[model samples]
Target: MITVSAPPPPPPPQPQPPAGHAAAPEPARGRRWPTVVTSLVLLALLMFAQSFRFPNDSAVTEPMVASGDASAAVDAGSFTVKVDEVRFAKAIGDGAEDSGLSDFAPETEYIEANGVWVVVFMEVTATEKQLTTFESRLDSGDENVYASTSWLYNTFGSVDDGFPPGIPIKGAAAFEVPEKALKDPVVQMTISSGPGQRLAGEAHVKLGLSGDELKKAIDGAEETLDVPAPEMQKV
Candidate 1:
């Protein structure tokens, strides 16, 4: 009949961890799945980003171009040219026997065009040096490029020799091109020699030809275009 025996001695007190030792970690399962999923998501995002490619400046190698309309001056750093006039012809000749440079008579050298011959007269002046070389081309509306014919060499003012410093030199070049070229014709002039025009400054002039105007010029083109010898301009 004494009061109920005192509750069993208090359960033994739990022991404290030794100094500096960590308590046990939580079960790994709880954190493992979330960590793995986060890692996988990051990896997937990285892979997805790698799938696309972008364009940069390295892909462009075209020359720097100065563009203008016919009769306008287009300067290309190295030199400048003005499209003074444009003419069309079916055939062209020098009409002279002696060019002084050679005994070669250009009078008998009449060249017939497969399509139509376009003649361009330009006033050129060198900005960088008195010496410069030029190669000409036609960038046509039909996406065709026609190079200037060498047959006109010496017959017309030859820029082949280049222009003097400061003073403008008169010259002309001929290109045999399809009628479609006139639809949106552009004359491209490149400085020739050395590495050959790549990455260099180039001149482009829109000839202002298309539709009826183009047709009229083509239809009325001369049968045989003859011109006097090209002369150098005086300062």
Candidate 2:
């Protein structure tokens, strides 16, 4: 009986799974945000290496009339002027160390003194030689030399002909005066003797308040030139 039972048991201890084959693999971990953050940092570094350097200096200077406190001037009375256009010219004088303003030129010159706005145009003339030199000299990096605006406590007037009187002519025109005019108001303009060099001619138009009439009109008003455009028309 024992022999028979042993024989049956020995038939087969069911094959046990080979060593580790039956063990399940551990659960895998998911992706983390640190990996994503690392990728973004790398991308940012690449983009930062790409950006413009600014220029060191500016050659042209803006005109003065455009600079001053327009608010104050507008507040004064009936202060209205419209500058439609402007002109310039260049000129040179013989044996002169500098052409002064003779090199500056303008194309048209006229003054429009209508309601609420005043515009002035003056002819300009400049020779070829003068212009060449002016161009070379205008290449400045300073605010003092080629500055565009000047102030006079009193009044500025043009002594030229063909100008009308009582038309509020007692004031300066905020026009562009070339380098020549900057040196001295009383300067000489001459012709140039060079190939392809032609005579320079032009006019300058300026805009500003008719200091004479505007000042007089404003003195009477409680709030003079300071009046706005809509209110100025009423005056």
Candidate 3:
């Protein structure tokens, strides 16, 4: 009998994809745009941090006696009497909102000297025109007596009652310095008839400082507050 028929021809080998056709591409390294951008950003931030620097504040000049005729008066020995530049500028606080320029014409403030506190107010023309005119009339004359409409002496008693009537005004009556407040240095002056009111007229005042020294302080303040005198209606 014949041997078993030969096994069927071997099945053809299965087809395989070409070497470069199907294998997953190797993961691209250092080619990521996002990663590169992120690295650059970090470097930039580091450089920026290194460049920053802080500023330092300068020292303040000490108070000095302003040179002038010792006997000069600022406002008839009432509001101001002397010129002490160092003291005048220092009267303004660091946090004060006003540039204090307006103070040159129709403004007032409180100050201290020789352990005394005083309020200072200058009554210039209350109107805008008067305010402008005042800027033109400031100067350093010894006998010049600029007439202030009214001036009041602030006292320690007023500190308690907030300035009662009977305070002296040169044009109206002889106002006396209360014995109780002889040593107190602060005084108040203003343009309004009352405290915290809009200025109705040109006026100014000084408090606390006193004597020849007080006069000198006001004169110094005048240098800072040299605005033209505002025109006043004739009586």
Best of the candidates, lDDT: 1
Task: For each candidate in the order shown, give its overall lDDT on alpha carbons.
Answer: 0.74, 0.24, 0.30
TM-score of 1: 0.65
Off by over 4 Å in 1: 1-62, 95-106, 155-160, 192-195, 227-230
For candidate 3, the lDDT comes to 0.30
lDDT of 2 by residue, 138-227 (tens): 111122223222221111222211212112222222323333222211111111222222332211121233345434432332211110
- Kindly provide the TM-score of model 2 when superposed on the true structure, using C-alpha atoms: 0.17
Stretches of candidate 2 off by over 4 Å are: 1-78, 91-142, 145-156, 159-235
Q: What ranking of all candidate models by lDDT puts the best one first?
A: 1, 3, 2
lDDT of 3 by residue, 1-235 (tens): 9899999999999777567754434434435767989999999999898766323222122112122222343332112223222133223211222456655534444232232212232222222211111111111122232221122222111221221122322111111222223322322222233333232222222233456664565445422221122112242
TM-score of each: 0.65, 0.17, 0.18
Query: Model 1, residue 91: displacement in angstroms?
Result: 0.3
Candidate 1 residue lDDT tens string, 42-63: 9999989886643555325456
Clashes of 2: 43
